[model samples]
Target: MRRIFILIIGIAVLYSCRNKQTESNNIVKAIAQDTLSKTVAGTADVGDVSPKNDETVKLIQKQLKVLLKNDLKSMTNEDRYFYYEAFDLNNDKKDEYFVGFSNSYFCGSGGCSGYILNHDGSVINSFSVTDFPILVTTDSSEKFYNLLMKSGGLFHLVKMKNGKYPSNPSIEEKWKGEVPKESTKVLDIYEKKLEKYSF
Candidate 1:
């Protein structure tokens, strides 16, 4: 009879522990959801830019995990933070992703790093020594919009050549020309806002 009592107690304890774990998991999920909601607040339903879209968000996060697999191992908690904005760079009415990392590990004296991803999260281009507020100009190359990225305190015109932007902006010529009319600045403070995301 004592053995049976001990068995029941063991089962009960295990069940209690599982319930507590489940509750903890739920709390974590709740916190994540709350953060996501705040991150996407005041954003319009234009495209997959909304973090409320769980599937798209999950897919983007998964791709980032794979893309930054090596860097992830050495990244500190601060380096795990990222920000992104979606814009139709190709003018297909579909948004391509512009993800930026601003932490010390990703930044240097020249500038930081950013990734331009296609609609499906495939990397279209990865640029080093790049500064934010990526400008989408009215100019076109290979049927895609040209970009003006700041590096070394000067704007570099990043025209799509052979289907990719220059991997390093520090070597590109400075943008001496005027930003075309109707051009938009993405990830800027006033317009084309960025959404903070934790990896």
Candidate 2:
């Protein structure tokens, strides 16, 4: 009777191990399939530029994870499209990912703000583009001087500094004390000469 009990226990443990292995395999397979399906199909969506490569897509997804605190890959096409952009107009020599978010429980007419991921992929700089669709326009004459725009004619001309920008000055460490620039323009303020509401 004791021998029989030991044999049964061994079988049960083996079965449980197999089940766990199967579950892990299934999860890995699902992730591989999802990645394989990634495409520049977002062109028809709200972004000014579609994510053209896997690196760009993965980086944008990482930024989305930081901002939304969830995997935006599961969101519907319309919702995802309105909030994200992955491209290289920033002239950081690396692509940037931008996302717009609202402070309220849900986005209202008041509009949300923008978060731009830095080149190294570890930090982001914040500015208000008001709301989506956050239109990114590159300057033909100057590189990295991208114009960010939202609805209600809200616009901001943001220049990506050659180095990291502070995420939050209140937090210390990351604060660079505002690098000197030839232009004293306030980044998020809108101007008519820079164009308005139209990308």
Candidate 3:
């Protein structure tokens, strides 16, 4: 009788331990599944945007807003407001625009970077630069410029030119350590576009 009681107690303990281990594993699996589901659902929402010619600009702006909202969740409203700037690039007689957002405090750090839509609300092209870019106006031409601190003291100055689609990019200029070199022809092209749009 004593031997039988000891054997029963041992079996009960072993069963309890095995059940607890299985429960813990199930909890971990549930958490992983939930995370994966959320990620897939978020991506699907972005993909649903219609890429029609007429709707492209609106869609791009909407996407930018969604991305910024998600990425800058930790920022206060005022801080978030200072992070983005939008403007038209080309003189296509349409209101093409560029939108830029900074992820770091001030404008130059690890963060988000992109271009805005033209009047047609379509994205022309976009490239990423380290740090937050500031919109600078020099003698009437406006551009998106940023400094890459991680690089060997190089500055990237990007200008959007107004012209037909699929043509050579209007202009993409890079300057190092100082003000960009000014070219009369480049200025003239910008001025021409500005004048055409100003009226």
lDDT of each: 0.77, 0.45, 0.40
Clashes of 2: 0
Two-way TM-score contest, 2 vs 3, winner = 2
TM-score of 2: 0.38
Considering every candidate listed, which one attains the maximal lDDT?
1
lDDT of 1: 0.77
TM-score for candidate 1: 0.69
Report the CA-based lDDT of candidate 3 relative to the real structure: 0.40
* Model 3 C-alpha lDDT per residue in residues 1-199, reported as the tens digit of each score: 9999999999999999999999999998997777567445432111122222425434554655565565566666544532122332333445444444433432343334445455644566554443323333333333322212111234444443452221111123445465433211111112222111100
TM-score of 3: 0.33
Which candidate has the top score in TM-score?
1
- Where model 2 places Cα greater than 4 Å from the true spot, the runs are 1-82, 101-106, 140-143, 160-199
TM-score of each: 0.69, 0.38, 0.33
CA lDDT, candidate 2, residue 130:
50
lDDT of 1 by residue, 1-199 (tens): 9999999999999999999999999999997787567435523223233443555566678888988898898988888877777777776988887878777998899888878889888999899998777778767899998888889888988888898999997787788977654566665623445466778
